[model samples]
Target: MEPEQQPNNSVVVVMVPLTAQSHLNKLLQFAKIISSRGVPVYYMGSTMHNRQAKDRVHGWDPSTISNIHFHDCQLQLPQVITPHHDLYFSKMFPLHLLPILIQLREPLSSLLRSLSATARRVVVVHDSLMSFAAEEASLISNVEAYYCFHCVSVFALLYLQWEAFGKPIDQGLQGGDIIPRDLPRVSFEGCFPEDFSEYAAQNIQWSMLDVGNIYNSCYAIEGRFLDLMAQHQSDKMLWAIGPTNPVAFDSSAGVHHKCLEWLDKQPQSSVVYVSFGTTTSLSDAQIATDGLDICNDEVIKQRFIWVLRDATDGLDICNDEVIKAQLPNGFEERTKRVGMIVREWAPQLQILAHSSTGGFLSHCGWNSCMESLSMGVPIAAWPMHSDQPRNTMLVTEVLKVGLVVLKSLI
Candidate 1:
């Protein structure tokens, strides 16, 4: 591995994500793309997070790429809290991530300075959630920071134009906020709790210091929202560079062939791929809801591949007894011939791109949405929490490529 200090007098780009699985995955892909074009890219995060991102990254390996580097910001994280399955994802954000966010500013500032000292022009791209890093980047004269929004442009526009929608920031929301009356009546409860809104509101100001904003979407997917955002914040530049994951699978990376093999046997456009993103899991009651659908003769006859996160509380536990108990009696045996239940991680991109993948029943996480769209697979949107409902709106309401499976899981 090369040392952190690169040769002097050259332009460099620094990538800083929120250090979550989804956020790190997207930023690493962006870094790879930037490095392929001859720009030296540094992916900055904690040692554990950096390892997790690199180890799980699909498509390309960063080790073989010369210009792409990993810089560890050595900050001791507190013992993280395990989230409860019954609570929505947004409700647990402060408990799990707030400590890490609080401690990152010092290390991030120092790293930005060290990198800036050696490079002629330093471009730092940090997640919108990590506005503190962008604040630090603004302090250095040679450094330019851009906010990479993890959610779709539409999700942002709703909050950015909250006042325009007749909801003043001072009043705050009752339960949580809702979309403008003209748009579909979707709520931010999926990602925003009322208690956390004030904190998020405060950090949004730091984003004003950034040079511009970036999205993991194209004008085609969010053209109107992107245009509206540009007009709303005309002072800053906007770039819609997205579908950052590899367009095609790289087999040499040791792709998971079981999912692909099952898809090959199904007729073209005959299968429905079902998976919620990593963190979101269904409760036992919800599992029974799925069993009812599977029991329907019309549905049971069709080929289906479902990734069931057997972990009850999003822990590492994979209890087969718990999984079987949640399902309807004979659910597994009845569908054994036509259905495949994946108890572990299934290769998503390869499944979405397969000829037999006609639809995706997804949580509408931005990464999954982009991958499915890029592969021309439609969606059956079932959002869990945190920017997901809004992303679901983008998929169902605006893009017209998918439909809402349910408004609320509860």
Candidate 2:
């Protein structure tokens, strides 16, 4: 049945996601779920980002869902200028996205005030990194703001500990640091850049003012960490509503993705799926590792599908030039039957759900972790940066469902 054409507005939600692909994709899935439940959702972002999110969604078309409205904010920002020197890919991504917070402040506030006139309550669910953009929600009448964390509970717990109590020294944590001795010690070794401290502090301070916090996680895997987080923030409510992406794509919808067709030809439990999320890209040297070039005589025989993203823009699809430049010489021809390389943007859920998919070689991004776990696929956790190192620990140490490929950046 087709949903109603117009919103009646008992309660309205506004989703503000960071412009990164992983963040944008997960939040849109959450918006689709909310709209399906009869709540109207207004997804606000720059024109380019809004188009990217919609174009990149799989299985279903969000445009067909009338309740989910896409609002394109007009911003005259210039094209993102890439740095010539090497900065960690994860940190480099936020350098492009964080400026949007300052630009969005006034526009979001105006939208909230306008929505308040018609709706009884307006809920603003902004990305955890985007708190500064939604700060004005506190001043607007009938508007309530909540921080939506795309990472897991364990990472959040440790990140909050680090933000609250500085990096621990040889002298040990001073003052009232409430870190659990049992958990992995907080380390910024492969985490956020030093300049990001002020932004992290802003998010931490904003979290304190919000009434509730939301995570893309569930109690099944991170129940202990979630409970520990609740103890620390007794005044605020914590909700673990996750596995936000569809567990299974609707077969009845008749969507035929090409990757699934290839997987169908492989034997059960034969293929290892490889993807490193959106923002993390390997250095050229890292991409040339012997294990990746299945042509190497030393590596074990296996069938695999690798999603190699464009090095220039992690979210952009890799063109013929990128694939030709990045892959080892004749690597594609030597392993044609045993391997498949998707340049960018594979239907990850569909691939993970395939019977032939035995394991996932992933970057331990929280959304990737949740999707793999939901599909009963074990991860080979190769963490890159940000909260990924802690998320890697959650997968390998706590859940024991996966093994770590590398603990940190080489």
Candidate 3:
């Protein structure tokens, strides 16, 4: 069902989830902040997460915020995004997508219908993959739309655009005017010279610039896509904020409660915060074949918390015993004096902002980076996969806020 409109409601925001907690958490926080600005915010999503985790993360008992309203809007999703790991991310393409595409029509149709009737002048804010559907909906409903959540940096997007979607500037344009020959193309450590697919080499002309991908953050072009969408809006009060997932400020006590206990036992300014974003896993192959290979050789002289989650059977496999078992010889013994906290869960905001905290070792996930920057902590950016590597580049090269180890363009 679509959200019902109130006459006093000046702004209406619709949020769609991107599979997991990290994604939903950021979106919900942004909604809460916006709603607190005296604008009415209505959140629509079904009972997500297991019972315990849901209660713990969002115990939104009305007293949490003064203005925001939580509504349970159950949106049955496409089979491709169905929550199962195998079904969700098996391959880039499929042979039997006909039936799946047929199934998708219903949800897609329903999505458009709901937005059209209720959210008449809606400003749609969306996440990464959700942008595909949200863009489709906004186009059909003729409402303002913006892509949020995580947008990789200009270098990262250029890298992906060059490797996945376009060719390097060296190759020159095969069918249209090129983007000038002087600008250097981002290096793809994983991409091969002859790796050009049929779609990769195809030309994308300038008239189609508006059809390019949208990112949440970038080294250049802040709010470009959103501004393009809102171009005709001279009199309308319509704009897109961000796909922000904010941690509960009041819950800082609970987060701090757990963090302070950990810090109380350890030395001040010694513990390192390490967390990989949701859906980005570090395989032993990803460890041996690519990223962690470079990170493994780095010298560590301080106490640390290394967040390594294995992507086996869709469960976080980096338990205490599992972590100790997989580590190379002498890693634990050598770091014994320095101390390493190995927990599947940590209060990230509390840990990052703590006075005792020194630096962050991260995958450059947008939310984590934002939290670290807002708290004035320096970052050791080790971006693992996808847009993360891109975000890392801008942080180091453009923002000069962090240190990027290597530019592994995905």
Candidate 4:
């Protein structure tokens, strides 16, 4: 069971995140941590994705760091497939990038080999969706590969494994289904997107077989699940190295000073900061109804900031006119004195860290959840899709730090 000898001098960590903002952010945060410790990192992605990564790094003051490199695999995707719709791209892009990644492995390895001579090793850390491709490429190039679960709890991983490999937990278990008996109770129903159950099942199977796994979580919060994972899956190495907020590493000046300035004006722990991550979009109907309810409520109206991102694949709500048309008539004018509606991107980490920020109205995405918890801000979990429901459960039911806002209320 001796470890294989690597070439000397340089250590290279290749990060291949699914072409999603959240996924990329997590991997980049991990890469920064690795690079800060003296290892060189090669962040691999499609040409467009690499460009975006470069821009993001530049925004974060890249000149301060020298070891993290953006390696474009030169994947030319079709015009029909845009980066904004990362959910679709996550499933499809790998088919196109896999062969290209496989081909680039040798050149990547050779380039790393040329760097130095004392324990030179190239480790491929990839998003869960890209694990299959990364595993094949790592095998071909004789490099180490690890699956990075950028979002989701350790319990989510365990659930996926159980669903995929273990006997079907009674189909009739309904919303009250408790899983794994030992772990904290989480609703089995609506925990995952029903449409992609099969896809998730397959990924979980492969992820279990992979060399190891990385999570954007830490033992401080999810130690029980981590411990359970270790007890059961002793053969696999699970690293809980996160709460990986980019603000910890990036010193991007003036990114959101205005937001902070406004926050400073508010009473401490009085404002409720609201955001639904990057991907989830509120339907026009939901916005007209539920959106107005929250905005117009006397209690919530006085101290709220809602970040409303455009529906990437569907509507162009980024246009002020479009946003106006979608919102309930006079909603903005009604709440203008008390609330702020951010149309596009907002500097989330800064806002969450602010003293004036009392609570979070979040989609319960793992990143959002972690950021909120890290800042000691409570939450009103309103999950829209994917692993969010499960994360909501962790926040509300297990952690006792948050409450779930039922979709019926939203």
Candidate 5:
């Protein structure tokens, strides 16, 4: 691999997710695209937990092609703050980001102003939640900007961008910034209307997650007065690129099927890999936070590979210790003979695509949904947050391919 040139300018991409689930995944995909093209991509986020993951994409050998340079440019904590548990503080990045832009816009802009300023142009791609600040940074810096929506453009236009798209900048929410109203507010169902063109395909799994749910298909989903509000910017400057999460079982680069390598070496399709996705530590909004904890002890008499985290606090572990304690039971000893590999860090896509992989146990994040769909694998949807219930709605309710363990109860 060719070493990267000392970039003359940089494109700062920020993903300041109010809540860090599928939103972060979207920003990373865009960073991957820009980096794939050899642009200098500096991704930023509000919290360190999210930022640490942002730090890892640069060294990704997934495709055996490393073209992106990752850097952390935005920090939003430990200052001017309204404290809350996993909730998002929107003002942290922008109110503070403007100050940083003053320092960065000049020299960096001068260097990347030209297409061939001895380096790739500095572009800013932010998650929709934080794109307004990125937009401000781009205006002063004279660089390009884009927003990454890992799911469909629907939620990107509505849910994440609700404040920017729905409410005027000056108007405070009905509740303070921390408490997002429980009712569905912003709507974009009409803007990104459903296109069921893929329904004809034989492998219906790729179409597992619906655009309707991803973007909130309700008619009330879009902002009311969009035409006038929309013209604030030119179509050429702003972009909605990538719903680009490419994966394959046959190896070429980005991600290939080597699940078999691990599963093949191990045992049967008995092992189960679980990852609700990064943003699910907080209680899921749509699904009841109750009953979303670990499964009950009845093992179905099978060996397993469970990919879980220490999410007891969020799952209400103290109140739900019975469920937790039952996890390592008489079945584990007997099941251990069947073999069990438990981990918090598993190559999930690889695990799901394995030949011996009997099935998947997922929280139904769109990316993970698509991964399983691309592999035509079935799952046990344990949806955990905002659109996850909706995304899971598409998975189990619409597709009829997967099963929800406790749907009647949740």
Candidate 6:
């Protein structure tokens, strides 16, 4: 390692996001926001993720966005052989991440030393899931680490702490079970698995104990919960500088432009844009009963553009046979003139920002929630799993900017 380079009046922020699209989107947006203010950002991720990040940055002018840099830290791991692929990847991620961080320390220190004397501080910002690795690496590298909660709310973080340290709550409580006063409006049945909760609580506790925290929410939306957390954990620094929608870095490609053009043709405030974020998948039965039934409605069918992304299973949802089989008989032909069904990823932010977009039908993921709100579009929340149900409450009850739809209805 090199001698400590202590400069003044400049900041070099190192950001490490979990190798997932939603997580990367939030972190990259934050990186852009900070870099725009003259700070330099060193974004670390895998080769593929770095490529995606670079592509997102390509939309911005190089002269204005020149401070953001990408670093590839690809991991070497054996082929996974598990049915629970996401779980397997999550478990294996830190093993790969730690080694990369170890290798990065000396070079990062050298880069800091090479900077002008005004470059004073080096802060490492990491996803909450990588708390363990980041905490350890920051200690070794002598950089300040801040954990970014990219997905869940600050209230969820407090609930995790309460679950871990406070009086033990029943893990198998039903949906209507009353939550303790200290916790947020969350249902036990809607919570994640017990094992997942345990893991999250452990890591979140580590983050709270060892590092500062960053939340991807603004004070207007979650100020009460943020205040509660700050009061409870007075020793640490917590910042809520978000609703971090990367509107400035959105791609202006032909495909995206085509989507905008289609929206432009529609009447203002007439279209309802529907998407379930990136990870959630609709079952065949759910697709037939829920999707078809909703589109079959006379009013909605005319002004809806549903984005049915088949990302989880890699299924070809765009195929005619696949669409016909999944939807009700003669459904597509009947709604051909009225509605549009996009079988892959759509430009969600762009669509939301369009004048014709009246509302959003979303799975209540934090990123989707932020994007919808940022665009001033109302939400029709249909939460599925993880922290979504709580997010739905935030949207419908707290913010009063959206409605909650029962899962059975959609």
Q: Model 4 clash pairs?
A: 7-120, 8-117, 8-118, 8-119, 9-117, 9-118, 9-119
Winner on lDDT (3 vs 4): 4
Model 3: C-alpha RMSD to truth?
A: 7.8
Candidate 6, 175-273: lDDT as tens digits: 222234443544444255455555656666556535667888878777877877776678877889887765443334423455567787899998888
Predicted candidate 3 versus true structure: per-residue lDDT over 1-410, tens digit per residue = 44455443244555544434555566666666667676655554443322212333432433466555555534343333212222322321222222222233344445445545554454545544344444454456444544344433434444455464445545523342122243344555533223222212321221121222333332232343234333322333333333233423453344434445666667667776666655444544444444333333245455665555433211222123323214565655665555553435555766676666778877786667766766677787866544576567556655678896544443
Model 1: colliding residue pairs = 190-386, 191-386
Clashes of each: 2, 0, 4, 7, 13, 0
Off by over 4 Å in 3: 1-11, 20-22, 42-46, 49-63, 66-120, 135-150, 158-184, 187-259, 264-268, 284-301, 311-325, 328-337, 406-410
User: What does the lDDT come to for candidate 4?
Assistant: 0.62
> Cα deviation in Å at residue 77, candidate 2?
4.3
| Model 2 spans with C-alpha error above 4 angstroms | 1-9, 81-93, 145-147, 166-186, 252-255, 290-298, 311-325
Model 2 C-alpha lDDT versus the unseen true structure: 0.71
Between prediction 1 and prediction 4, the one with superior lDDT is: 1
- The residue-by-residue lDDT of candidate 2 on 150-242, one tens digit each, is 454555555547555765522223343334455556565547765576787788777566777788878887776667667756887888888
Best by TM-score: 2
Give the alpha-carbon lDDT of every model. 0.71, 0.71, 0.47, 0.62, 0.41, 0.62
RMSD of 5: 12.6
* TM-score against truth, every candidate: 0.85, 0.87, 0.62, 0.78, 0.54, 0.76
Question: How many clashes show up in model 6?
Answer: 0
lDDT of 5 by residue, 301-331 (tens): 4445554333321112113231221133253
Candidate 6: give the clashing pairs.
none
Model 5 lDDT on a 0 to 1 scale = 0.41
* Model 4, backbone clash pairs (residues 3+ apart or across chains), number: 7
**What C-alpha lDDT does candidate 3 achieve relative to the native structure?**
0.47
Candidate 6: worst 10 consecutive residues by lDDT?
80-89
Q: Is candidate 4 or candidate 5 better by lDDT?
A: 4
